[model samples]
Every structure is written in C-alpha cells, then in structure tokens.
Target: MSKFDDLPEARRRGLEKMEEVYGFDMSDGEGDFFRYTADHLFGDIWQRPGLSDRDRRLLLIGLLAGQGAADVLGIQVPAAHANGELDDDALREIVVFLSHYAGWPNGARLNSIVEETIAKARRS
Candidate 1:
C-alpha cells in the first residue's frame, strides 16, 4: 500500500535503498525533489556496484564536510553511525584528516557534529 508499490522497479528499489540507508521509512516522501532523491540518488547512484555503502559514505562525508554542509552532515553522520558504517573513532579521525584540506572551520564544525552524534548515541 505504499506509494512506491506502484513505482517503476528502479524507483521502488531506490526508495527501498533510501529506507535501508537512512534507517527509516521513506515511502511517504513526495514531490520532484523526493522522487529524484529516491530514484536517481539512491536508485541509480547508490546502487552502483563499484563501492560498498561504507565506502560511499566515507567519500560522502569528505565531500559534505568540504562543502561545509553541517545540516546534511547532521543527518548523514548519525545515520552512518547507526548503520555501523563509521564508529566514533573513525568519525573523529575524519575530522582531523579533513581539517587540512577542507579548512579548519569546516573541520571544527565536523568535530562538533561528530561529538554530538556520538554523545547522543551513547545516551540512547
């Protein structure tokens, strides 16, 4: 009965992948942005076989951090941890490594987000 039930196979797979990656039901999302996110980003890109989800997540973390995308990182960092893709130590190391290339300010922001995400997980 989900909206994705009637979608094309690729779209359905994409939505399912989004749920798996984000660890939540995403079938209620709507609109073009949602469609592209599920269908293209998740379906076509994330589904590609060249890299594991963990690999992709690591690359994405660097890209997002370099772009100073704290809001998106807020979602991605926790999801990465919850999915067992990145542990607290690995996350902390990324902050140190990317600081040189992505700039100290962006690295500082990443550090904050990483610590907050780890602390929240510990409290749960």
Candidate 2:
C-alpha cells in the first residue's frame, strides 16, 4: 500500500481534498510548510475522530474569518462548497453569525472572498 493508504480515512480524505482545493504540490519549493500541513494538520490533527469534515470546515471558516485571513478563505470557502461541506445558505449564515464575534471588517473581508470564490467556481 502507498503511504496514502496508511493514513486514517478522515486524514486521507482531508489530504486529498486539501491538495485539490489548495493546489498544494509537496514537490514544490515550499516542502517544509506543505510537509507540516500534510503530517500535522491533516495526518494527525484532522484524524481526531469526532466531528465530520463539514463540521471542521465550519470551524475553519470561523477561525479564518475571526483572524482576518481572507486570503486563506479564498481557498477554503470554495472548497467547502465543492466538497459538500457547506451550502450557500450555510455559508451566508456563517458570515452573519461570525460578524458579531469576528467583527464586521473581518466578516466583510471573508464575505468578499466567499463571493469571489463562489463566482470563480461557477465559471469554471
């Protein structure tokens, strides 16, 4: 079996999805960061065995929005949609809900990224 076969189901799915969503190529120059993302984030942490990927995606959106990480949102928002982890209404609700806790500015930035990513996804 491949190393990928050794990964837990959630981690394997998350890893494949991350590559598809982020266009991550571990062979690229950013090997260290990609490796950590693969080994720690997806391989270990995402395998914790409780919430589903949809639940995790929701939390990730909240964290990214709260931290003003719109750029990362550019990737994650569409990925959530593509993978069936989020729908349009759920995405909108997330923005509205997080606006209070994350602040309007961060929410606005995330909202913009969400729209742009959704549009891009539709076009392609």
- Model 1: residue 46 alpha-carbon error in angstroms: 0.3
Clashes within 3 Å, all models in order:
0, 0
Per-residue lDDT of model 1, residues 1-124, tens digit only: 6567888887898988888888877764678998898888998999998999999999999999999999999988999999999999999999999999999999999999999999999999
Model 2, residue 103: C-alpha shift (Å): 0.4
Could you say which candidate leads in TM-score? 1
Q: How close is candidate 1 to the true structure, as a TM-score?
A: 0.91
What local lDDT does model 2 show for residue 43?
A: 63
- In model 2, what is the error at residue 81, expressed in angstroms? 0.8
| Tens digit of per-residue lDDT, candidate 2, span 1-124 | 4345665564455576456544543322236776677656766666678988777888888999999998788878887887777877788888889999999999999888777767777798
Question: What stretches of model 1 exceed 4 Å from their correct place?
Answer: 1-3
Best by lDDT: 1
lDDT of 1 at 37: 88
